[model samples]
Target: MTASRSSTRSPSVKVAEVSPSAASCLNVLILPLAIFNWYGGTWIRNELEVVVVVVVVVVVVVVVVVVVVVIIIVVMMIITIIIKNHNYAFIINRVPLYSA
Candidate 1:
């Protein structure tokens, strides 16, 4: 069984619905656009690769450093509160009872 697909596609083609010739013209133009994109992309990729990599590495390092600093600050804050509470408790317990 030989199945030949329809040259004209479904009604889902919006450009063809607007103008019949426009869709065919658009199809013809795709090859040049694709070629330009391929070459342009390679040029951009080569020039930007180092900058992109450096920016990504710097961002990652900054995030890690910030997270570590935040964690250290939180731990120190918790320790400080615990120590203050302990000292307060000890001082309170040591006070002598006064007669009214």
Candidate 2:
């Protein structure tokens, strides 16, 4: 027995053809997505770096404020001591008056 082969071939289907306007729109939409995909890791790293810089700035500001307050307190204490010593010296140097 001989096997018979079919002579009819299948027709090739064509995919959808895009218009020029639609192709331009696609390019516009895809450009940002492509850029993001390429630089996504760098974007995340840049955000982290910004956060670190802000934290460092806050810490430095706090340290500077604390140092300024300490200096002010030390200066006030020194002034109080000097004033007390001046009053004591003036009182001690006063002459006693005898009745005429």
Candidate 3:
């Protein structure tokens, strides 16, 4: 009876010891994965932010260039019209008018 009781108790004690070691092993395996996930997510977010800023800057530069070009073209057209009108008036004054 004594030997049987000891055998049963020994198995239970062994099981109790093995349970803690198994739990520790699981922790060891899972901790690195959790850390990697946190850092990896942050890295990806930083990269996305940089891309957004670059795209916005490029868009702004393009819009400014287009606006400047349009203004220059409009100014040139106005100057051309003024010069032509002045020349026409000078030519009319130089011509002689005869009364019939």
Candidate 2 minimal-lDDT segment of 10 residues: 1-10
What digit string (tens of lDDT, one per residue) describes model 1 on residues 1-100?
Answer: 2344566556787642537686566445444445766877434345355446546766998999999999999999999999877757767777878855
Model 3 clashing residue pairs (backbone)? none
Residues 1-100 of candidate 3: C-alpha lDDT, one tens digit per residue: 9888766754435533458886686556555545766877434255455446556766998999999999999999999999977768777887879755
Clashing pairs for predicted structure model 2, backbone only:
none
Name the TM-score of candidate 2: 0.43
Q: After superposition, how far is residue 47 of candidate 2 from its true place, in Å?
A: 1.2
What's the distance in Å from true for residue 5, model 1? 45
RMSD after Cα superposition, model 3: 22.7
lDDT at 27 for candidate 3? 57
**TM-score for each model:** 0.43, 0.43, 0.43
For 1-100, candidate 2 gives per-residue lDDT tens digits of: 1333245444574656989997787567555545776876344355455456556766998999999999999999999999877767666668656656
